[model samples]
Target: MPKTKKLPLNSLEWHQHPKLTTLLSGDCHQLSTLPDLQFISFAQLQSILDSCPIPVVKRAKVDAYYLLAPMPILKQLLGHPDSHKLTASLNIYSEPEPTLSTLALIKPALFYQKYKRLPEILHSRLDKAKSMNLVTPNKNQISQLAQISPSAFRKITHSQGGSHG
Candidate 1:
């Protein structure tokens, strides 16, 4: 009797895709039946990602506003030579919208893709302050109004020295 030869491992492209990673990580129960995760190349991986719902939305909404980041951090990234040309339009503060300043929200995926640094979102922190109802110049007021922290707010101001330009 002839012995059977072992099959080579599936393609390596599966792990390279962020969308794929998010999907597989998100719903393992659905993928339990998958025999193997071999994709041929980046293009193939991209094709699969394109077909998926979450990845599709994620890629499409890379430019879409998902939530707000503090203004100072936005300004800091906008002013930096390395990051400036990548994105603009951070000047999203409304003068009539009360005391706390804020930039238009950006998705975490967009931030990671652009800057390679995961920006800290202050929503949770702000929420904490609000739950406590601590009314301080720094904490409760800004958190309640803008849902962002003073430190995150200061990042942009620190970069621009309070100049919104």
Candidate 2:
């Protein structure tokens, strides 16, 4: 069998995806022939680098990391109709470390805002989201969020307005 090529220096890369694994990473070994992008599940990825067999991560720097909230909590907030409940939920997550899990607990509106998605835009930032203070959680909202986990599902890999890297 043929051997796989290795990536060049500073070639290892990673990021958090909205779906599938909190983080997506790619190493230089996998980067030589493919697009220059690496992906992986955040927690598992961290565990690997911390105790690596071949020591793939050299001078490893956390490029982008997210503090997540549990899916259940996020679902509850997303389902809650009262602003007070939402705020309460947010507080629960805000204390200590705020994981992507906690962020997932929020509605997409606020979630986008904090992450820098402008509220006025199609995908506005959380800061620009429809005033959660004015809006109450509705049955439809809860129903809509019934089955999602509080973690990134998959990373969207693509070039500028095109396919993944």
Q: Which RMSD values do the candidates have, in order?
A: 22.8, 20.9
**lDDT per residue as tens, model 2, 117-156:** 1111222222223455433223233223322232322232
lDDT of 2 at 92: 16
Indicate the residue-level lDDT of 138 in model 1. 42
TM-score of each: 0.15, 0.16
**Residue 148: error of model 1 in Å?**
20
Name the lDDT of candidate 1.
Answer: 0.29
Candidate 2: worst 10 consecutive residues by lDDT? 83-92
List candidate 2 stretches off by more than 4 Å: 1-12, 17-97, 107-165
Q: Provide the overall lDDT of each model, using Cα atoms, as 2-decimal numbers.
A: 0.29, 0.27
Best by lDDT: 1
Steric collisions counted per model? 6, 42
Question: Model 1: what TM-score?
Answer: 0.15
Q: Please list the residue runs of candidate 1 whose C-alpha ends up more than 4 Å from where it truly belongs after superposition.
A: 1-62, 69-71, 84-165
Top candidate (TM-score): 2
